[model samples]
Target: MLDLNSSDDSSKRNSLKDPISLNVGGEIYTTTLDTLTRCRDSMLGAMFTGQIPTLRDNCGNIFIDRDGKVFRYILNYLRSGFLDLPDCFSELTLLRREADFFQIRPLLEEIRRYETSVPLGLRGGPLGAILIVKVDSKVRVLHFNLRHGPENYELRTCSVRAFTVDLFCTWRAFLALLCERFSYKTTQGLTSPNPCHPRQNRLKLEWVPRPDELPQEQYDKQNYRGLTVSSPEATWSDDIVNMQCSPCEITDMQGFVEELLKISLAEGFKVDLVTPDPTEILTCTSLRLVKS
Candidate 1:
C-alpha cells in the first residue's frame, strides 16, 4: 500500500502525496495519465465541493464510482499503485486532485462540469463542427452548453461544469468533428436529437481560446446596461457562431479506455434510464486505442 498517514491534522493531509497508481474498470492504465501531480495536490484544499459528476462510455453506458468520488480513485493511486479504500468516490473534492495528477481528459471534464459562474469567461467559439460554450478555467479546453425550459417542452439540456480556473492546459489544437446519428440516447440527454434530424447539430472542438479574464473596461458596456457578463466566451457571435461542429473521427471513448487499462470490458455494459431525473449527457470519450 502507499505510505500515506491519515491524521486529523488538515495541514498533513494538505501536504500528502500518494505512493501508488490509480487504475479503473478493474484494469490499471497509466500512460501519459498519472495519479499524482502538482496540480492535483492544490485542488484537494478547496472549502466547498461541487456536484457529483459521471462519465459515459461510447456504448452509452454511464460509469460513476460508488458515492461519486471517482477522483480519489484516480489521484491517490497515480504513483505508488495503491488506491486506498473508504475515501474512494465518496470524497468528491479529492477527485479533482486525482484528475489533475493523471491528466485524464474525462476526469478533467467532470471537474469543470460544476462551475456555474463564467469565471474564466466564455463566449461563442469554434467547437469543431458546431459552436461550443467555452470556459477559461484551469484547463483552457473546458466548455459546455445548456438549453432547457417548459418553454420548449422537448427536453432540457442543462449541466454544471467544474475545472481549474488557473491551469495552462492543452487545447484540442487541430481537431475536426464528424457528424453522426446517435442511434442511442434517442430517449435521453436533453430530449435527444430528432431521429429524423440525425445531423441536427454537434459541437466537437477546434481552436477554442481560453481567453484572459476580462477587465472592468470590457465589462463596462454590459455593466453599464446592468448586464452581468459572466464569461468571455459569452460576449457575442463572431465567425465562430457561423462555424459548424461535426463528430470526431473516434467512435467511442470506451475503446480508448480498453487500451489504456489493457482489459477487455464485457460485450455490453448498460444501466436503466431513470425518468423525472434530469438525464445527464456526457460526450462519451471512448476513442480507438492502440497497444503500446
Candidate 2:
C-alpha cells in the first residue's frame, strides 16, 4: 500500500506551487502561492501553509481584510525580492502598517531604509527657515599731496565709502537658488551665537561672477590698461553697490529676495514675521518662514 502521509505532503506541495487569487479589501490580485509563501515566517506563508486558517471570498479567492491597493507593492516586493516605490509615493506609514500586519521583515526593513535616505524637505511636513540679511558700511581715508607754484600742499580726504550686505540662510531650496545664482557655499552643523539653540546647517550668500562675466584677474588687467587706473577700493565698492541695486537675471539682492519669497510660498511656507516692519519693504533685514 502507498504511504498516505507521503501522498498528502506531495499534494500540499503541488497546491502551494499553483496560482492563487487573493481578494484584498475588495481588490483582486492573482499571484502564485509560492510567492505568497516566500517569507516562511510571514503571515501569508503561515496562512498558505495551513498553519493558520484563511477566509475566502465568494469568488473563491483568499480574502485579506487589508488595503488592496498597497498590497500590489507588497506582492511585488515578494516577487522581485526588492522594494520600489514611486517618487511621489506618500503612503509610507500606511504601507508600513500593512507590512507589519503581513509580518514581512524584509519589506519593513526596506521602508526604514527609504525613510532614512529621503531628505526631510522632500517629505511632506511642517518645516521652518530663518533668513538674515546683514548690512555694514566702511569708510576709507585718503591723503593727497600737490605742489602749487613753489609751495607744497597736502590734502587729506575721505574719497570713497563701501556698503556690504550679506544674506544667511537655513532653507534648502533657498540655499540652492543662492548657490546657483551667487556661487554660495553651504556650511553644515553651524550653530547660532545663542547657546540655547540647537546646531543647524547654514549658508551665506555672496555674489560671484558667472562664467560669462569677466574674471577678476582679467577685469583687473583691463582696468590697469584703461585711460584711468581704477582704484581697487573704488572697484570693490562699485561691485557691492551694483550687486545690491542693479537687476540682471536676478543678480541683485532685491531680485533674490523676491525669488526667495516666491519659492517659499510655492513650497507651502508662509512669512511668519519680518524685522523692522515699518513699511512694505521686499528686502527685509530678517525674515522667518513657517510651513504647516
lDDT of 2 by residue, 1-292 (tens): 1111232354654554467888899899999877998999999988777776667676777788898998999999999999888764645556766887898877877776676677644432225555555543344444444345678665533233333445555544444333333322112311122111223435543332222333334333322111101111111342221112222333344555666666556444566777667264475666666653
Q: Residue 281 of candidate 1: its Cα lDDT?
A: 20
Clashing pairs in 2: none
Candidate 1 structure quality by residue, lDDT tens digits, 1-292? 2233234445643443333222344343232322333233233222101112224344322232332335435544444444344411222234434454444444444334432322211211121111122212122222222225656433222222222111111111101101121111111221111222224332222111112342333323222111001111222254211113232221233222222122111101122221223232222222221111
Model 2 CA deviation exceeding 4 Å by range: 1-17, 124-292
Measured by C-alpha RMSD in angstroms, how accurate is candidate 1? 21.6
Segments of candidate 1 deviating more than 4 angstroms? 1-16, 29-35, 38-189, 193-292
- Please report the candidate that would top lDDT against the real structure: 2
Error of 2 at 168 (Å): 34
TM-score of each: 0.18, 0.40
